[model samples]
Target: MLLKNERISEIVDGKRVIVKKPELLAPAGNLEKLKIAVHYGADAVFIGGQEYSLRANADNFTIEEIREGVEFANQYGAKVYVTANIYAHNENIPGLDDYLRALEDAGVHGIIVADPLIIETARRVAPKLEVHLSTQQSLANWKAVQFWKEEGLERVVLAREVSAEEIRQIKEKVDIEIEAFIHGAMCSAYSGRCVLSNHMTARDSNRGGCCQSCRWDYDLYQLSDDGREIPLFSENDAPFAMSAKDLNLIRAIPAMIELGVDSLKIEGRMKSIHYVATVVSVYRKVIDAYCADPDHFTIREEWVRELDKCANRETASSFFEGFPDYTNHMYGTHSRKTTHEFAGLVLDYDRETGIATIQQRNHFKPGDEVEFFGPEIENFTQVIEKIWDEDGNELDAARHPLQIVKVPVKRPLFPYNMMRKEN
Candidate 1:
């Protein structure tokens, strides 16, 4: 059996060739999520610092936290990249040079940059730090990729609008490393260049304060000849829509691997730790399985099921197959529901006593059946027959968030193993 980090040999044309698997890149909104990403088999994790990040609302990392996260990921052979992808204004320019230097000193692998100002400053101030062009640049053509390559960018995150054929063409023409968004939310505008947030909520979508105005509902109205207002439709009709369905590309893993894309990125920096773990683990398995043997590769139903468990919105393979149609765009009310809910996280496990210590994430009572999963172990379902608090007192339910609890287990679990229950 082929394992991760091992290259596979394939016969292309009439010659045998060696193929290195693409890196699995995930997102981290905080230190805990960063650890969860690496623990679940991410090859690299991208995080946003406190400044110059589009995810301004996220609990971004401090320099010290970045250093700690780097150390944690390094132990698992994973890399850390910091995001400075916001389009900078005049006031955002000051102290950016210092921040770039600090990220380099903290041993970050690279910085995902969008603004010309930040890119130039990183090149000038921190020459050793690798610079990656963010997807915000919207480099959809091969010539744009060539331009960045000549300008000294190590990689380009292609715009989400780029189709599968476009990606293949870009790879054929440009020799620079290619990174593509494999799964996550899709931007309603062209590569997230929307002004709706700025016009409606006074929040700049480019410079980090996006209010997601595109996802909001607005009353549809029409004007009469007398200049009076009129309702466009009855209350039963769906609202005027602009939101796009979330991207799920599990079915396209084999094609992406064959296209020679260097990295497959998951786009959710502001998502929960449960989200990070679930999504990363699912992709990790899919990529490894396909790379193990290309000829016999088949998309597993369990992989799709695992992804569906964490999805908060409707999902579709957008833009990858071809130009998206009406099915790609979401209208009316979106059901932000999933098949499962994260119940707890494993803190410690005892083999002799068949007991496991867990930190509660959601409410669970005795007799509730929960499923435990991790990167190294097969998933198993167990019924909660008894629960004990940290003080060894019996508890009726694991209700309090982050509360420590003990439960009996049939299989051994390690730290970072997550448990979820059917919703």
Candidate 2:
């Protein structure tokens, strides 16, 4: 599923000019991750609120947090989008109306919504906030995009099934902005409009309490005419037939930009802050590199290596070019591999002492090597030569989670920076 970026050019005043890079849109499950995503170079970040979004399991933002997040992102010239994309019943509208008004008052830049009623409600209750058609709408063609555009949506987050050619065609006919999922998880169903979780667990997937029923293992059984039950296989013997490979379109930046895609989205709202920082940072570099010098654009191996650290599933460019094959599905039990682990988070560093106060996440010994990375800083490597616990006691290793330790280092480290070790 690897896609190489092809050189795309157009004549402007009898001269060839390269296409511009699209806005990099990252996902944030909470306020902390939202700030991290923006600081890591995302031009915009999409987040789910406490209700009416698909990711109910995520640590979604509260009203106060939403206000703060919007203010924080605005300081950096970045935008915050609140997700109210859940399919709602009659019981949900009143609350949704209040929520949309609250968001508009909180200064949110846009609202990602799918239901027609929700969109119409946003227009009525919060007309100032831009409306983005969520992927849940399953918009796959120009007509659908036009339909949503006519419904007053400013942007359309297309379904994951769209191809480059389809995207180009849609842009050619549509006036609204186009967004595509360039990275992260792919739903077994179309844009996650599923009854599996609802029917299996009574936790409605459309209303946001998806139990990920598709990712669960199931055993098939048959009932014979003789009233005897025949087990096809045990749960352990069942395959992950519904699990699709995680999408990684790191190599498609040039082509995506050339297609006039208004936004490039990464889809992980329930993922870790480390995952947010790593994925956003990698894509940021790729996009910046291509935008800076399109003719010399080359997908760096370092970017791939960085992305692999946080990727849970094997990577693929699902449906970007055409229908994907068996390679796009992770059918086996052991299908994912993480190449790095979050070792610790740097809290603060003393310049004169050259000691970094770190909060350990995963265990790392005094002799272990780790890499530290943060906003506006090149990833610097440091060997843990000497370590001491906050109790002023020397330690052979930082053993427990959340253990505070001080390590002497030559390079200056900033607070909120992350440190990782090879897995």
Candidate 3:
């Protein structure tokens, strides 16, 4: 990865000053995830509505959910940006206007869009809402940033392919704000402009119907002129040919902030609430640490360990360097290597009784030791002396999904804190 100490000069009274710390952006597929994200310390959350969203498979928010999510985020002093990032067809325009107006009424802080027509429509229909240019447009250079700025974009999510030097240059040239994918899945194709999903699954990748064809294991083959198929590799050699490693810039936060990135986006709207909570919490800490003392900033090993506990694939700094080669690609089986799994979330804590009401997410026995962690408190592990259901029945384990249960905790705990058990 590019670990350069590049700095931009700002003429403040003929003196240079670095920009403010970037916002730690997180993804929220639904209202529950939105709550988890905000509670976990995300400065801003990006969500997709029921229509015109790229992640169609995600449990996108309904119009009412959007209103509720906006309100929920506002309470935390965090911003909510709704996605209207679909590459729309002619027939999608009429409903687009309605959706934009509804989002405006929902009180969203901003709209993330990709298409020029949609951008123009948002400018006309919901002028009060801030318009953010999505990464789907693949903005790589200063000129493209300037063009989007001229076209009236408040911020642009820079193309994933842009290098660190290019990002610095773009910021130096364009007066508009810049957002970059600091952490998340890296598309094998240019910022998700892949045609493979469309060709193989008849689902347009550009339209948000990507089936993740790249992550599938495949065997190499070659066709002869005589129409005979020859195997290039044995079945044992079948590999995750196009699976790219997940993007992680935990160690590069200070460097990226110095480059003037306004927002650092975390991808994966289809991820679980635990994933959103874990990733956002780590990034939030790193950003705060850096902003507090840039000169004395140091990357925390625990922050990296926390991210690894939730990442689905191996982590790498994609294209933030120059061009990534085979190192960026995961060649074997695609899998997550988490040392622990989410056990449950603290629903309510009874301080007088020294017990916490939790909604179980995974199986955990009464004797099993688990760690309790949250946004502000230090993580501590405690043995569960007893696990009782909501009806007050003592249980050997809390196994049911979303099962309300009470577990004894020694230290003071609060709602939204996470519990995790060793895998």
lDDT by residue (tens digit), candidate 3, 303-418: 88888777768888888877888888888768866888999999889989999999999999878989888986788898889999999999988889999999999988888999
Task: Give the runs in model 2 whose Cα sits over 4 Å from its true position.
Answer: 1-19, 218-240, 334-337
Order of candidate numbers by TM-score, starting with the best? 1, 3, 2
Question: RMSD of candidate 1 to the true fold?
Answer: 3.6
Model 2 residue 226 lDDT? 100
- What's the lDDT for residue 69 in model 3? 91
Please give the CA lDDT of all the candidate structures.
0.90, 0.85, 0.85
lDDT of 1: 0.90
Q: TM-scores across all candidates?
A: 0.94, 0.90, 0.92
Candidate 3, residue 88: the lDDT equals 88
Poorly placed runs, candidate 1 (over 4 Å): 1-18, 219-236
| Model 2 pairs in collision | none
lDDT by residue for model 2 (1-423), tens: 011233445556665555555889999999989988998899999998888888888888999999999999999999999988888988887787798999999999999988889898889999999999989988899898888878777899998888999998887787788889999988878965688988999888888888777776655678999999888776556553777788988888888988878899999999888899999999989887776667768898988888988877787888997899888876656355577888888889999999999999889997798988887578888788988999889999998999999999788988878899887
Among all windows of 10 consecutive residues in model 1, the one with the lowest summed lDDT is 1-10
